[model samples]
Target chain A: MEQTTIRFTLNDRPITHAAMPYRTLLEVLRDDLGLTGSKEGCGTGDCGACTLLLDGKPVTSCLVLAAEADGRKVTTVEGLAKDGKLTPVQVAFIRYGGLQCGICTSGFIVAAHALLESNKTPSEADVRAAIGGNLCRCTGYDKIVRAILAAAYDEGELVDESASMPVMEKPLFTEGPM
Target chain B: MRSFKYYAATSWEDAVAMLSKNAAAQVIAGGSDLLGWIKDDLNGPGAPRADLLIDIRTIPNTSYVKFDAAGGLKLGALTPLVTVAESADVLKNYPGLAKSALSPASPAIRNVGSIAGNLMQRPRCWYLRGKDFACYKKGGDFCFAVTGENQYHAILEGELCYIVHPSDTAPALIALNASAKVVGPGGAKDVALDKFFIGPRTNVLKETVLEHNELLAEISVPAPAANWKSAFIKVTQRDVYDFAVVSVAVAGQIEGGVWKDGRVVLGGVAPTPYRATAAEDALKGQKIDEKSARNAGDLTLVKARPMSQNAYKVDIAKNLIARAVLSLASA
Candidate 1:
């Protein structure tokens, strides 16, 4: 069997990996690349633990073959935090207590990141629909929804305020929308 | 996973050639189901290995859905589940089909998994999906689902195989009377959705009419009639990506509040998508009032021979058909 050599961009860096024909992207991410953020809760696509972004679209990495990802851009939770800074959604997750055991955190964060990227002002229902696939055993999803909403508000403000204030470290303006 | 030869098809021609060369080869676009089969060792012990896997996700045209001059819908086999669910054209013309596509696996899965893969998904029978007892669906001597833990087993079409067809989109397509275009070594051919399924009696080893190395290229559905009204209703334990305990998809023309030329199909209760001709007949020339809908739903389950543990499915099936009918009636 000839190994399929796949070259793709991961975490804003180009990388090449050799894998068997049927090897899933989850295997390539966790086994070959040692990026354990994407977990495989269920080998089938039911569980959201293996969620990642392929070309800016959220998809179950466990279902996507690594060979299919050749020359395509792949984004994992590791890619969300740029320049050693937590993504807005991640910060909100920590601040709002979005998770408990954190087994499903990476997948949730990935889903949330996708939501915030597309929609700046996502309603609670929108947030719910975005992360509907992710199941959390401990938190009961209240904090997760709050975190996503808060992140959306923060993202909306950041986009608006960042234009005025050059190089401001803190994103949240306390005096803005409550 | 056992070692298997692999080929990444750079083009559709290359993919067809690869499949033509190896009869034992399996096409892997999204590894969603195939990976689980390998990880669980669902294939029988000492089974003939699949020595070749052709990756078709790289084929550009195979991943797009196009509108035709005939006002029909064309779905490339590799079109992702999310695309099918969210396509405006699909939602407008085939809401039932789109809703089935949106049955909600994890967001990530919907994003990458193909609609063709969903219809081609292996049975979800725990016995079949699990490594435990080799059920009859897997060419075993006895069906473990028949007498043991048969809660999720099929209610109808259980004589030959107790396995339920896993695709949520399949029942909707069956209701729409869709056709699948198959491309293989022999060339292209179209098959009706109903005739596409092969029962266990025909070949215990195969699930669909697709021959070895035959690739499902496209699925085409006719445009909805001017008076067409349709709905897909699924009863599941959860709101998310769970398979329906029982589901119904109905499409028909409702004129002056009377259903005519209707097609009703049930899912999750049979080996193939169960078409309720009796129910269709009952509603064909009748107005879809609550009384008539309930009566028609009663006819839907007339032929249902549910197993002892799956008797609840009969009631659920009835309610699903009723609900789908009422929804379509209101539309």
Candidate 2:
């Protein structure tokens, strides 16, 4: 075995860390690089909770080997905001109440942000396809989809004004049965 | 999760030489499948421990999709599944192959998963991947899937183990009559997709015929003839991101409202891509219609022996076969 030093552009910052060759990018990001924004829900590729943008494409960082990230551009959820201002995706997620537990929020936000970057206006199906791999047990996905669509609407130069979904206003039961 | 030596291979020759030199070394491009295996500690009879990993994605000129008149189609092993699914030439020439590529886990996965890696993905059988279950796929004596939760297990060729093939592209590639290029220390060689997969009967622990050091370099699909029509359809538990419950890939040569030649392949049914040769022969001289397609589909699953909990797969597979064939007939 040989000692490998991994150097890559992470979140617009050059990070040079000494990590094991078999370590995943998620482990290195959370443990070594001290970037814990990316959470590991499933160590496998099934869950997108560990999603990151590699060269502007969203991929499950849990499956990407750390050594493979050398000389590549990697973007995590921490890099979304700029100048201490929340991005549209973050604003929409808050306005639309896209998440409840917030464990899967970062991955969803990262995936949606990547989608909006590629396509200014994404259809409902497009949004679904983009975040299809992400698994969120709390949110039923309706709000998330709505928030992404709303973000797209905002990007089309429309004012973000609407009585969007309330945090918890939907009544499952209108009246008690006699 | 253990530390292992790594090398970024610059060329196929370097990769082969490295692999041949180190018996504990393994080759990986996307690292999606191999990392999962290593993290789960899923080492069994044929699932050897990878003490070293050779990164093949560093090899230049490996991600490409080229199609020409004489060569038909050429896909580099490292070409991302997303690229293959969205390629215009692939969509125009081989729609089934593209559909198969798109039908996998999700866009994020397809964005990083490689063409050859998809074929090399291990089965999702709980017993095989689970460290607790001592199944035949993990070099155990008995198969827990046969008596345990086997709703997603094999129904066709449940010889020693009942693990169904997890690859979505293998069936479509076999239906399209594709070939794979294997590079190794012995040099490169071509293998038909049909012969590439070894079933549980021959080797229950392993999936493909690739030796320890061999790598699937590329996949080449022949161009379709004038009247050739191909289609791939999958049925999954989840709508967008799940493996197939049952899938059918149909390709045929149609002339004069009759199918003179055809190939029918099924996924998530057998250990390997189950080639329904009987159904293929049955549709050879038949005028493909609703009734004839139904008959062919019935013939396709006639030999199926579904496990206790998976009898529903038979009906689903039959219906998909009919639908895929009928769609091809209309195409």
Best by DockQ: 2
Residue pairs of candidate 1 with colliding backbone atoms: A59-B108, A60-B108, A60-B109
Q: Per-prediction TM-score, please?
A: 0.91, 0.94
Model 2: CAPRI class: medium
Tens digits of per-residue lDDT, candidate 2, B27-117, equal: 8888778888888887767677788888899999889999986778999999999999999999998898899999988778898899999
**In candidate 2, how many Å is residue A71 off?**
1.0
Please count the clashing residue pairs in each candidate, in the order shown.
3, 0
TM-score of chain A of 2: 0.86
Query: Which segments of candidate 1 are over 4 A away from where they belong?
Result: A156-178, B10-13, B45-49
lDDT of 1 by residue, B41-107 (tens): 6666212246677778767778887765366898999898889988988988888999988883656
Cα miss at B6, model 2 (Å)?
A: 1.4
